[model samples]
Target chain A: MTPRKTDFPLDQCRCHLETGPIVLVGSQWQTERNLMVMGWHMMLGFTPAHFGCLITAANHSHRLVRESRECTINIPTLELADAVVGVGNSDGDALDKFDAFGLTPASGKIVSAPLVEECYASFECRLVDDSQIDRHELFIWEIVKAHVDTSIDLPRTLHYRGHGRFMVAGDEIDRSADFRVQNL
Target chain B: MTPRKTDFPLDQCRCHLETGPIVLVGSQWQTERNLMVMGWHMMLGFTPAHFGCLITAANHSHRLVRESRECTINIPTLELADAVVGVGNSDGDALDKFDAFGLTPASGKIVSAPLVEECYASFECRLVDDSQIDRHELFIWEIVKAHVDTSIDLPRTLHYRGHGRFMVAGDEIDRSADFRVQNL
Candidate 1:
């Protein structure tokens, strides 16, 4: 690998950190359960705990999201990297992704939306507001509960680029110098 | 540093990417051109051209953005990372971040927003739509052009995890075992 590829480490890069698509599993209109890929997702905090995500107005997930007013944000394990694009490029409007991908869903204790069985961590949220932007919607919510699979405490991770490509997060680096570089 | 400290990447594991602020530096609202640090942000795609991002409602840049109807999504560099936090934390309601951060603004060709002086790359976007989500309004944009500092093709990047934390993007890894990964 070249120097750039060799130095590719997820822990060291800040931009790649919070920019991956995880499975957003939730029930649509309360009864229909759905899962869509969201690279626009991120956690707002740890204390009160919050997560924010952007959804397009044209997408089916947005419709489902609006009716239920609840959802689950799952952090994908390294192994789920390929699955991320697989699910994201495809749409809930056309296919039954759960059955197509052989993915499983389970109900969560914290929120009404179902969680992806394969994901490592799940955040159950109650809608904070329904804000609009041109064609996309921003759903800010308060995290009610966080679920983790102790088995996959540490999994390989993936960050989204744009289209269908994803960069798997690898390696960890150390900061020997402080903000001033000479401070260390 | 402990191994665990270097374990999960700040980019991938930092929960604060959602809350960080950014200044959308544009030509000028009255005297100048376009730009705005949209706190209302999110990612929309992965390839063909990897795309995703958010646009906030309350900033003055939003108006320039409406006039130009396009802006670049600049992932902050390490040096301006704090500016990201400062911009996000401070409201367009109170003060102008561009002046505060000392970031230079340059006019964009196809779009309206100006280029942030210290940013790594600017994804020039065209307005996809400006729809309201529910309460907080958002603008959906599709990036049409990308301007990068040719010297550095954006190897590392920055992310806002809400509040004051920012994470730079890490390296890219091809974890796909085979080309068929997409087909699966």
Candidate 2:
């Protein structure tokens, strides 16, 4: 077998860790509202709709989300990559991310957290379970409200590739027709 | 405001559901073993890593995972898109998915579950928390061992976009130089 076929142990290079979409998370607590870039998150449920995000204690949004128990998940397209990085670069406690990055924050219907207007889609989320927060720094949230820009069907989004690199969503392929089981 | 600028309600769309990487889940219990394509998963922690995946009760792998308390998460690149769709089309209850799909399953280090050799990376996981299984059909797993194909770096991965369409990962953009805060 060739070297590429051999099973190699992934000791310290956790490059595969960057497998999710790069998102801008919005949080609000009392008078403090902030936006921070997040890439480690996933959908947990379908019927009641659950979302999970990992926020280390050091991030400013972690405290804000804990106090408010609500937040908004904003999905931005490739066009807003720079802004995504900008929001992630600044500490929310240090500056108002909205004013610093020139991002327009719109009020969410269900959550007090602000949603980025330029993003293609937004989900207003409420903290469902924080049992693992103290131990894992993971927050489980339920999406109560959803909004999208229907005019643009599929806007390209950004995916983080560790160490400052990102991959853009591109060229969709549809293989649904080949499946034997119609519904999944 | 332009039509695209208007934030319309995504009542049924739920487009934000596609926020994470598409992974192939490997499950085995007794004589029953299966490979099912899954897109709903997230990273929960960094040290002593925790991973969460939502598997509906209807899927065959759900029962196997519960009985075995172990599974493997295989990350496939875009080169295996057709195989991904093929694995998702059939019912694992009827046949051995490994032979049916012509997939190679190698022994895992810490778990009984077998890893897909064709995948770029594989995680041997053991179920850690099942409290949310009955209520949310969610499984929280801790990765015991990790494997990656070191020969290939940054291979294009497939991201599900719901309704049969999939987005391909493309082009790397580095913004580390732009960030004022050096560490995140």
Top candidate, metric DockQ: 2
Worst 10 residues of 2 chain B by lDDT: B1-10
Per-candidate TM-scores read 0.57, 0.85
Question: RMSD to the native, candidate 2?
Answer: 12.3
Locate the minimum summed-lDDT window of 10 residues in model 2 chain A: A1-10
lDDT of 1 by residue, A1-184 (tens): 0011112222222222243434455554655667876656644433455456777776778778777788877766556665665566576767777776766777677577777777666667788756533333557777676665444322345565533345444433233221232211
Residue-pair clashes, model 1: 75
lDDT for model 1 comes to 0.51
Interface RMSDs of the predictions, in order, are 8.2, 6.9
lDDT string, candidate 2, A1-184, tens digits: 0011111122211112223677889999999999999877876665466778888899999999998999988777777877888888778888999999888888787789998887766778899999878866889888777776555554577877655667777677787788664553
